[model samples]
Each structure stands twice: as C-alpha cells, then as structure tokens.
Target: MTDAPRTLADAREWARVGTELVLGAVADIGDGEFDADSMLPGWTRKHLAAHVAANADALCNLVHWAATGEETPMYASAEERAAGIAKGPAMSAQELRAWLCASAVKLARGLDGLTAEQWRNKVVTAQGRTVPATELPWMRSREVCVHAADFGTGVSFSDLPAGFLTALVDEIAAKRGLTELPDGPLPEVAAWLAGRPHALADAPELGPWL
Candidate 1:
C-alpha cells in the first residue's frame, strides 16, 4: 500500500493535485459539460463552484488567524456562511467560476508565507471542532476532489492521489464501523468512494443509503 500523506508538504501537494484536476475540468466550461445538477441536492454546477470558492476563502481566513495568533473566525457569521452555500442559487455559472478563481488566489496567498511550525498549529472549524492546521490542506483536497466529481466532470476518487485513497479507505472503513476485513477479497476502496458498487454480491444488500 502507498504510504499515507503524513506531513504538511504531502497534504499540500495532494491538495494541489485536486486543484489542478478541478481547474482542468472547468477549463472549457462553455462546452456545457457542467449543465447537469451536482450530487449535492438542488445544486447545479454554479452552486458547486461557489461552495468550493467559499470553502477556500473560509480556510484562508482560518490560516490567517492561526498565523497571527488571533482568534480568526472561519465564517463571517453562521448565517452568512450557511447562506453563502444555501444561497448559491442566486449565482450565474460564469460568476461562480470567477469566484472560485478569486478564492483560489486568496487561499494560495494565505498558505504561501507560513513557517513549518505554523503548519502544525490548530484551528477551530466553523462547526466548532478543533483540528490541526496540517489537516486543513487534506480537508481542502477532499473538497476539491469530491466536489469536482459531484459536479459530474467525470473525475473520481481514483483520480485523486494514491496516498489520499489510502487515507480515505481508512476513513471510510472506520465510518462504516468495520473492524475486521471481510473474509473474502478486498474491494477497490477508491472506486467505491466514487459511488461504484463494491463487494455487492458477497453479502446482503446495503441498500442505496450506504
């Protein structure tokens, strides 16, 4: 198995890969490839992009807060942030893409000057949980990767870095509360995350929700 990304540089690189994949998919946005609704309920391509942009901006703010030793709020307000996501309905496709570009620039600037020590600093998430700064890059990677696919651009978890896949396998396995591997052959964990059926015939139906 590939070694998981255990360092900030590794995580950042993974996040960069996600960024490249997403941006590349959006390169020819006028081709109508993004017309379908995303996996997120009621979200079209525009809303998906906007949510990605907003998340980047939010992460940038958290990084800035960590760097300055001040309590940096990830969201302007709970309502505004929720509205920023929930209100993506108001955005046009072109404007959403622009916002994503702007958000990427802002986040890049925020990450550029951090010292190695700062990379390990902890930040409070908008959801009120504390997570290490080292995890932020991975979180960003997850958003960019999954949301890109959610937009129906054809990217999938298999397209993500191998190390990311390994970590995700660990995560998904844990979330399912599976402690021991099945007695049968293991499935391709990455493909499963991208909504592919895995080990379906081996047992009772897990149904659609799982």
Candidate 2:
C-alpha cells in the first residue's frame, strides 16, 4: 500500500504546496473566466474558488473543535454548504482571490495554535466521519489539489505530486468500489477515477467523487 502522510508537519507542508498551486493557477484569471464553467459539471470557476475558501473556514472549525473540546460543525447544514458555494460567483475576481488566500492563512493559523495533545483530539468532518485533528491538513491538501484541477485552467493532474496521485487513486478506488482501473500513468488513472478527463480510452465510468 502507498504510504500516507505520516506526520502533521508533512501534511501541513503538502497542504501548503497544494494551496500555492491553486492560487497560482487562478492568479491571472479575469472575472469572466472565473465565472465560466469549470471542469466540474454545473460549477463555474467562481463556484470552485468559493468552495475552496469555504472549505478552509469549515476545516478551521474542526481545528477549533479539537483545540477547545467544543462541538463545532463544519457547516450549519447541507443547505448552508450549498448556499456558500452558490455565493462564490457573486464576488469580483480580486475579492474571490483575496477570500481564498485569507481563508487558507486563517486555517493555517488555527492549526498552528493547537497543542500536541489537541492534535489528537477528535473532530467530525463535514461528511460526519470522526477523525483526529491532524487529519485536517491531508483533507485540505486533497481539496486544493483536486479542485485546482477542476478549475480547468492550465493546472492538470500531471502537475500534482506523484505520491498524491497514487494515494488519491487508492482513496477514490476504495470509495467508489472500483477494483479494476484502466492501466496508464498514475496521474491519468487518478484523474479518470476522480471523474476528470484523461487520455486513457478505456477508463471506467465513475460517479461523483468527493
């Protein structure tokens, strides 16, 4: 099995890299391009950008939950989550970029304040799975990397780390009950499994992925 990120530090660094990549890709986009449809069906680059920022804030809530031993839900409700995504396109490109960057910084700061013991505290994800606070970085890393690709800008699966691609493929395969995937480069296979376009002709059809 491919080894996952072992330490909180490693996960944090990976998350940092992922965030930088996403920001870099969106840095030059204009308002119209940001509002255009992204690779994700029905979501504009604006929606994707908004979701990324909101996800950071939501994960920050998890960090708060871990540090304070308080129950802080990722979002108030599913409707709130949808509403937040819907609200992304309303911002100007500059505002959207600022929001995304600021939220990411805020989340990092929140995480940095956690004590060693707090890192082991349990927090519930938006999906309702209980996990250690240390898991937040990996969770955030996956979000930024994949959603950056969903932006359909120059960023593609090939731009991601090889290890991340392998781990992502394993995670997607397990989640989707997909045992046999088309043979190809790790990035292409991972992208295909995640419902992204890839060069492989015989890639299996997949439903929505997280």
Candidate 3:
C-alpha cells in the first residue's frame, strides 16, 4: 500500500522536522565537504543539497496550486530542469547551500497560512502523477531528511525527530516490499544506510540516507 501522508497537519510537522535536520547538517558544511562525494553514486554533497532544495521548491508549487488555484510553475522548462539537476554534480559548496536556502524560503512562504481544504486539494505533478497538497510537505520532508544523512556529517536516523523515524520505518518497509512485521520487536533502525538487500527482511530496519 502507498504510505501517503494522512493529514495536512502531519505533513507540515514532517516538513518542519525535515527542515531542521537539513539546516543542522548545513550548519556544519565545510568548503571541501560540498565537493566530496555522497552515498548516491556520482553525486557530490553539493548536488544532493541542490536536489533537496529543488524538491522543496517543487513541493511549494504544488502547495500554491492547491491553495490559491494558481499554477506555480516549478521548473523553467522540462529541459532546463533536467539540465540543472544534471549540473548539480559540479556546483561549489557555497553555490549549493545558497540555492538550497533560497529555494526553501520560497517554499516556506508559499505554504504559509494555507487552510485545511487548500491542503487537501489535488494537483497533477510535473510527472503527470496526481497527488494531494499533503504530499508536497511529505516530499519536502523526505528530501531533506534522507539527503541530510547523505552528507556524512555524522548524523544518523536516531538523530531525527522520533515521529519521523517512526514513520520512516513504515515507509522503508513498504518500499522494500515487506508486508508483514518481523517476528520479533523491530530492530532499531540503522543510523545510516549501507547496502541494498534483495528482501526487505534481510535489510536493516533502517535503510541508509539517514
């Protein structure tokens, strides 16, 4: 089953937790760290940061579309969006952090003061998938929380908000195709991801990316 966000408030809370996690990691980002490769193959820490911010902006667009009946275009164009993401792998640390902050601010403002009905409105994403406004907050949360762990800043899943860790375990289990809870108490999620497993049960309770 799809582990969609259950409510607008829950989504917003997730967003708040995600933002804190990202900013905490950013606070420790050093000049050389941005260029360092992350767990995602071929992507540096900078690229991951950029991707997280861009996703925040994208989610903001969906929020605006739902709230105001306005089409807040996320990408300049399909080609530009794709190319920009591709170029993220080469960004300087300063550039990446700046972009991330800027994008997040835009999204934060965009989401401000939205009503519950607005948050429940549905919209078609750039990929043509239809989703609720609640999904935007969840998307932002996922990007920041997971990619923050990718930075290798020594933070871990346990460092995340307790609610986030609890919810994320459910998400990971679903993603890994596990339908039943393990026989024993679920293991403490790993602090960081290591490798992919063929079966969900074989994988650690916590998948990497924090």
Maximum-TM-score candidate:
2
lDDT of 1 by residue, 141-180 (tens): 7778666666666675557777776666566656666554
Expressed as tens digits, the lDDT of each residue in 1-210 for candidate 3 is 235545656666777777777877877988876778776777777667777877777776777789888776666579866666677767776777788888887887778767878877887777677777767776677667666666778665555666665566677666666675444322234232223122334534444442
lDDT by residue for model 2 (84-138), tens: 8999878889989999999999999998899999999999998889999989998
lDDT of 2 at 4: 64
Clashes, model 3: 1
Checking candidate 3 for backbone clashes, the offending pairs are 193-208
- Which pairs clash inside model 2? none
- Over the full model, what C-alpha lDDT does candidate 3 score relative to the true structure? 0.67
Show model 1 residue runs off by greater than 4 Å: 1-5, 31-35, 180-188, 191-210
lDDT of each: 0.69, 0.87, 0.67
Q: Would you list the rank order by lDDT, best first?
A: 2, 1, 3
Best by lDDT: 2
